[model samples]
Target: MENSTIVPKSSLDFLTQLKENNNKPWFETNKPKYLIELNHIENFAGALLHELSKTDVLETASGKKSVYRIYRDIRFSKDKTPFKTFWGGSYTRATKERRGGYYFHIEAGNSFFAGGFWGPNAADLKRIRTEFAHDTEPMQKILSSKSFVSNFGTLQGEQLKTAPKGFDVNHEAIDLLRYKQFLVIKRFTDDEVLSPNFLEQALETFKNMRPFFDYMSEVLTTDINGASVL
Candidate 1:
């Protein structure tokens, strides 16, 4: 694993302060510290990505050589800290159009990571939804796996089974929409992210779940024929 510095408490505090000081000239005043933190996060993300790449798990799905990135979308939001509360990383096969990335939620602490195919546009969503519905059993099996279930919380999975909002799982396409992406959601609480043993456990969990991604990759690459899909 590439070397990473423990994200400093002072750094997080400064970012929180910057977010609260809307009227003040915080950016100009704290330019150096801000730049340093940004760089530090970038390095940390890169290191984490390197560690992930060492495993052959993310072959076709992740699409890019450099997996980690900080999301740069900050429009009409109350939180105006220049730095992000999270960093994300992922890879995909060369054939895929774009990189598949996952988030490291900082507010929930950084060891946690969640990833799956996301529908940025209508066409993408359509393909994913179609595939999800086509091979429901296999998809459900992976989602319900002990390892996978642990990540999303058992209660959340049961809730998802009922479908979203007014949607019913008994409905045809609508009910199956949530199953479209092969999401591998893992949680690392504050203690886990901050602790070495917990962090190691988290990484091992990612490694163990690698097979599920492999299964999804195979299914996605296969033709739409229902029998051959999963």
Candidate 2:
């Protein structure tokens, strides 16, 4: 196992170059450099996974599997950039019972770690909304806890302008009911990303997400009666 746990300077430098020369020709010429950086990132991810698995089960098979492709699909977008200028990835929790996911992004000035339900299907959305409508205290407690506040600051994601159909606009939990997505994010500076203990710090930050994750997981896996759905 590779012992180095820091994000290499070369990786960031290469990404900076890639941002300037995002065309196919420039990328083709610099493929070897990219590969080297990718390897380092893969190893870093692998190490992170190894630590993460000690506390949580993950569906992602390996660090390499968690890394997102640098390629950008521009099939219908105005921004025709062929490649991403940063390293990004995610890990999904294993099994139906475990809800939420973890994500990491490494970039020059905009690196962050985030986890939550980016998208909940119609059924899941309704379920979460119903739970919040009935009782927002549980979720509220998790969001307001000191660790949660210190780490992520607050819950974030898209929200409806008004109440959903069948939900009263003046509902007590209307703020919670308006959510279209659920996410929490923590940012890090470039210097922090390159630090030796960044891996451990990342793990701790992820650990702080457990209260929110566990709450959501329980809400998701059980029906309104609190019986197991899976």
Candidate 3:
């Protein structure tokens, strides 16, 4: 209910202007405004972290720590835009026991909440594929649940056009096994992002991801014998 938790219209306006004028000169002139908006976003991230900690453990120390830098790393990119057009951040769950992560992106028309394994290592990918190949029912049930469907629509991520080396193309769980990354996403409209209850709504969306996260955590932390790896 705090004012800091609310996304101010001015903040969004500033981002919109930044997108139109992405040059360093324009940004330098408006640096003060940018800093003010960043503070609001940091407060929102901090408050979200506080609420999230009540239900889950996080390794992120503070809201500021969770926020991604506004400056884009363009060393390897063709688009040499010096500043990012949006504000984004992520939260990593605490310990090796808790797998997966949480992310939020705030932009004029692209606001979204996303969480899951963006890039699984070779070992973890193989293990996950093995589990799906053995039995897809558990993961299938979670993905097919009403809450999951309502929130994320469907499982999403990069996938191999053909099955991975060890997985059969015709395997029963091949659809899931082909995935190289596991992710779920929920988008929000500008109206929704600027709403008073946006913070609470964001928390609810994160909470809804628990079943999928818990399932992956179990798979990643154990061997075939179901013993802890960590």
Candidate 4:
């Protein structure tokens, strides 16, 4: 029952309790514990924000903007759980207009640091695919680097069954072109998340993602139709 957590040690205990009692009354009773962990995450978010700002990735970063709600949107779900078992958040680009950035997530057993251009719109996807089609080397260099591959296995996302209309089936970068979303993750275990060095490790992982983000920035920040289209 003692928490010497400097930066969000773990909500694992509370989450386990929530999973067992997944009801309003139980949650109401445990509100204080939830708030304590929530504040821990807020502090973690603030530290992450500072780290990101150092690299100019997050412009006007705020812990409030970076942290996500613990409650789940259960309106249309079959399970209909009122609260989530984890906490997470996103750090948008310093430009504010840029569409893709970084994400931090913490769950009982599935903690990870993720980032990239997730689910880009049709127009944005086309632009990026076109860029890859013409010059795949730049993006390929980043994805294939030792640090990138070690930190993030690969560009993880949904892909189309067939190639887009403008590209041929035999195109060299067809695989990259077929991607509908560009997301990547670096996972961590429960012990790792609670470690004193967790913040340092998280920041380093984020640093490695810079090249990939920089590549996306070219398209996402390009002035198209008089506005930046992520």
TM-score for candidate 2, residues paired by index: 0.97
Residue 127 of model 2: what lDDT? 92
TM-score leader? 3
Tens-place lDDT per residue, model 4, 175-221, is: 99999989989999988888888888888988888888776876566
Q: Please, what is the whole-model Cα lDDT of each candidate in the order they appear?
A: 0.52, 0.93, 0.94, 0.80
| RMSD of every prediction | 5.7, 1.1, 1.1, 3.3
Candidate 2 lDDT over residue span 34-118, tens digit each: 9999999998998899899999999999999999999999999899989999999999999998999999999988899999999
lDDT of 1: 0.52
lDDT of 3 by residue, 2-42 (tens): 48788888888998999899999999999999999999999
Which of the numbered candidates is closest to the native, going by highest lDDT? 3
> Who is ahead in lDDT, 2 or 3?
3
Comparing 3 and 4 on lDDT, the stronger one: 3
Q: Which stretches of candidate 1 lie over 4 Å from their true place?
A: 1-5, 22-24, 57-94, 97-100, 108-112, 120-124, 154-174, 178-184, 197-202, 226-230
Question: What does the lDDT read for residue 200 in candidate 4?
Answer: 86
Given candidate 1, what's the lDDT at residue 78? Answer: 75
Report how far off residue 132 is in candidate 1 (Å). 4.0
CA lDDT for candidate 4: 0.80
lDDT of 2 at 130: 92
Residue 88, model 1, lDDT: 43
List runs of model 4 lying over 4 Å from the truth.
1-5, 8-10, 96-99, 222-230
